[model samples]
Target: MNILFIEDDRMNRRVVRDMLDVAGATMTEAESAEEGLQLIDTQDFDMILVDLRMPGMDGITAIGHIRAREDEKAKLPIIVVTADAAVDLRDRCIEAGADDVIFKPVAMDALFDAMGRLLARDSDGMLY
Candidate 1:
């Protein structure tokens, strides 16, 4: 699968990239939300993992922009990969269009499981 990870921290991106590599998934790195949005216009990805906080645009705002797209890309599955543990974080992410929320430091199994579940959705957008 092709995954786009939008994170400002270099180490965080590298760690996720290595994990994705093990799953035979190609992860395209984006250092910021703006860069990720631009990439979305030029490429296709099976999933998107966005950091909650970044320089300039936040992950929630990015997801909103993606969901606001005029094309089919608006339905792209998104996951919020955040370190924050705000009680309402998950709700906020879902409200902003994320399919799921996974906290950091992320475990490989957790990441794989979230991806598998979201990608396994049926045509009606229900979990299968």
Candidate 2:
């Protein structure tokens, strides 16, 4: 599957990229929310993984912008990756249109499971 991963941290990006590579999934990395938004506009992806905290245009704002799109891409499955596990943050992400939230340091199995579930739901036409 084609996945877009938006993260500001180089190490985190490398780690997720390696994991996705080993899983035979293609990943495109974005260093910031602006870059991620631009990529979303110009590319097609099966899923999007966004980091919640960044220097500018945080993931929540990014998600809002994505959901604001009038195209079908607005409904693309979005997973928020965050180090902060605050309840309010999770709620905010969900309210902002994230399909799921995964905490860091992410476990490979959990990430895969979440991806699989979302992808399955999407393919089954159960996801919006």
Candidate 3:
């Protein structure tokens, strides 16, 4: 699967990249929300993992920009990979169009589980 990970921290990106490598998936890294958005415009991805905090734009706003797109790409699965522990973080992400939310210092299994769930569903929201 092709995945785009938008995170500012180089170490976090490295860790996730290693995890994706182990899963035999290809990952494209973006250091900021702006870069991630530009990547989205140019390439397609099976899934996106975004960090909540970034220099230019936050992950939630980025998801909103994606969901507002005038094409099928708007439906691309997105997972919020954040360190935020706010009481309403998950709710906020869902409201902003995230398919799932995974916490920072992510576990390999959790990442795979979330990806699997999203991949198993068709665009119509039915199991494939």
Q: Candidate 3 — which pairs collide?
A: none
Which model scores highest in TM-score? Answer: 1
Sequence-dependent TM-score of model 2:
0.93
Going through the candidates in the order shown, the clash numbers are: 0, 0, 0
Q: Tell me each candidate's TM-score.
A: 0.97, 0.93, 0.97
**Order of the predicted models by TM-score, top scorer first:** 1, 3, 2
Local lDDT at 118 for model 1: 91
lDDT of 2 by residue, 22-108 (tens): 899999999999999999999999899999899989999999999999998898899999999786987888889999999999889
Give the alpha carbon lDDT tens digit for every residue of 43-94 in model 1: 9998999998998999999999999999988998999999999999899999
Off by over 4 Å in 2: 122-128
